[model samples]
Target: MNIRITGTGSYIPEVITKNADFDNHEFLNPDGTGFPQDNKTIIEKFKAITGIEERRYLEENLNTSDMAILAAERALENSGIDPETLDYIIVAHNYGDIKHQSFQSDTVPSIATRVKHKLRIKNPKSVGYDILFGCPGWIEGLIQAQAFIKAGMAKKCLVIGAEALSRIVDKHDRDSMIFSDGAGAVVLEETEEDGGILSHESGTFAFNEAHYIHFAKSNKTEAPDDLRYIKMNGRKIYEFALIHVPSAMKTCLENSGKSITDLKKIFIHQANEKMDEAIVKRFYKLHKMEMPKNIMPMSIKELGNSSVATIPTLYDLVLHNKIDEQKLEKGDVVMFASVGAGMNVNAMVYQH
Candidate 1:
């Protein structure tokens, strides 16, 4: 059996946080000393590198599960698929539903289960679970959904990537500017058609795992704060993505029996605009081909990096022609790629 993406949807919170909003906030060093650069200069530097002008953050009352439910509802409606017919609901997230201000999280009742409850899905046979493969969680969920259908274990599946990353980010850390909150979802159905997910490649560089994002205790001697917040070695991750992501994309396209000329669009994780552009260029150069302009679409300038939700949300936007210059026609070959916290990288080839 082949698996096809029947529908796609996404939800971004109402609150828009612009890069200039950070101008008043002060960044502190581990020792409590203030950073030399002011917020204005910092924001400019971030824009120069990440190409992010603004991002959306969940409101005080919303959580990851809430966003997932909204996106999933839209996806199901778009697909005209009955909730009862869904064989699986896979929610990909890092920080589960965290209560506002409390920082309390509950994963016992998985985010997927919460989404299922919100959707009022009554079928006990329809399983709900979560995947935590870092930023590649959603793509991994899609890969698993395809496997289930191919094995006759499922017919239709809902894959969602939701992240309330704003809640987990340290307001004083510059990394806070890079993460936002949102959700994106897709409905996958078993199809006999020739178009669907064709091939995928995924791997982890465990050695570099320590260099990526992680939660750790504050090391400030004067502050002595106990709160754990998301921290990362930005330079190291940039290097890693520049080196490994291109190889992963190449391997995936080769495995799918396709080449750069066969691709319609490359939907990459909205991590950083400069890094993504470099990776795509290197990918084509490896094949001795010219870099195709307008082939790689990006939304980081407006959406920032919502972790796993980036690719799916961008995909949904492009699919609906919401993106100004991007278009996808039936039978188009699209590729998805991502790299993040797990020091993991993944690429998938899909036929639209």
Candidate 2:
């Protein structure tokens, strides 16, 4: 019944888009006039708040499945496991394969199936599917893999989170700066020891769903006709994370029979550096303990928000010591937490 992540891999697109790359002219007023703030001022304010300087975007011809396959291949190699041995392949994503300049998405065959095909997985028993759990999709996939292993339904599984968000994002919207594309994957296998994944918790607050990110048209008359873009109520999401995310992590730790004092690191969703910091600080405060600096590692400054890909990618970085000044040792207790669209929040406790 024991489950552990044996290997991790991630692939970020080579194209880097900096905050300053956004043009002020794109954000026009209702009357087709320019916005008050110049591009420089907007970039500064955005970086000051989100702590993001740049993010990667998939190549024009790339798709979510392509990134997922690349990451999965690396993970399989890293784990020393053959693709034929995998019993399940779970992909976490909201948008499937989306072509450039097209609003349509392909989801019928599922991105997991495409990933399986690209990886040349021949085992008929290795089922592939997708999960839609908002930004917590990747962590949710991990939770599902744990369930499968615990149920004796599978011995090995591949969990991947990939997104080609850049294709769907409306460049004219400022929120587009926070969306990017990347893929991260982990190979999970049955373990004899009780250490790996200890506990997990996930839920949704339907009332807040309307306030978070959603596809909608621009309110300005001058905006492109019939174009949909990602829109968000920043204040609402910030408040939701500050209140709900910490509570979810605390509950997860408590469920695992562990406490903040027992944790070595907290890998949070790379949504916003400031929001993540606040969430962790508030979580520790609830236990009447001061938040430890460096406990919560973040990559939002360079990776932006790739939704479900954030946790696994960050985990892979820390495991390989790619994260500056941060590394995970064997038997270390770590927690993961993420909150976003779906008004969904999730947390998991794992022993390294």
Candidate 3:
């Protein structure tokens, strides 16, 4: 029996925030020191490096779970599967439901349970849960689904990655520009198809990299210390991903018995454009080959980094022809990889 992604869906927030929107904002360093350069110059530098000119923000009335539910509904509809038949619903998120202008994260009932409830899945057998593995959460959830299906614990699962980073980011920090809100989901189930998940890898390097990403006081020194927002050492993360992510992808692809020449596409975490390009370049280098043209699909240019939602959203877009000149054909071998908070990293090889 093969475990396959039967359907996929994504929710890209309607709010479009262009870089020009931040032209008048006060940007500050983590040390609370003001940059000598003007905001326009700073934003231009940011755009040059991250290749992000715009991103999406969730509406104030909706929460992370709402986005998950929307994506899940579309996934279910695409799969044409009865909700009652699902054996599991797993949601991956970092900050939970943060109401508009609210500083607190609400995760009491778990995002997965909230999504299941909102999706109106009434079957008691359909267990719901959430995993907080940073940006890699969705891919990890898919790996877990594969295990459950292979172990005979479940045959059908709904895995979702959603985030409302706009609700949790510190406006004063430059990193805030890299974050946006979005959600993506997939239905994984048993199938007799010839190809599905072939191999996967996961790792965590918390001994020294633990604090690479964490919540702390806003970059604005005058802000109350009692309230904190997402923070990260961007340089360290870029260097770390460059050295590690490519190797992980290589291992996953090799384990799948697929050659370097066989890879048709790669769905990498939409963290940064230069970093992603560098990582994929090194992966090809490892195999003693040059990186293939258009081997990777990127949504970060428009959607920004919506944490776990990146890969699935990109995949859904490509599969639906929403992205120009990017599509997956049957029997195409693709790789999914991500690295994020928890200082975590994961990769998976899949065949369509």
TM-score of each: 0.97, 0.96, 0.99
**What pairs collide in candidate 3?**
none
What lDDT tens digits, residue by residue, belong to model 1 across residues 245-306?
99999999999988779998999999989999999999999999877979999888888999
Ranking by TM-score: 3, 1, 2
Worst 10 residues of 1 by lDDT: 216-225
Per-residue lDDT for 336 in model 1?
A: 99
Write the residue-wise lDDT of candidate 3 on 1-352 in tens digits: 9999999999999999999999988889888999999999999999999999999999889999999999999999999999899999999999999999899899999999998888777899999999999999999999999999999999999999999999989999999999999999999999999999999999998998999999999989999989989999998999999888998998898899998898999999999999999999999999899999899999988999999999999999999999988988999999999999989999999999
Ranking by lDDT: 3, 1, 2
Using TM-score as the measure, the top candidate is 3
Segments in model 2 whose C-alpha atoms lie over 4 Å from true places = 23-25, 28-34, 208-211, 219-225
lDDT of each: 0.90, 0.88, 0.94
Q: What is the C-alpha RMSD of each candidate to the true structure, in Å?
A: 1.4, 1.7, 0.6
Candidate 2 residue lDDT tens string, 57-133: 98988889999999999899999998999999999999899887788889979999999998888889999999988
Superposition TM-score, candidate 2 onto the true structure: 0.96
- Which window of ten consecutive residues has the lowest lDDT sum in model 3? 113-122
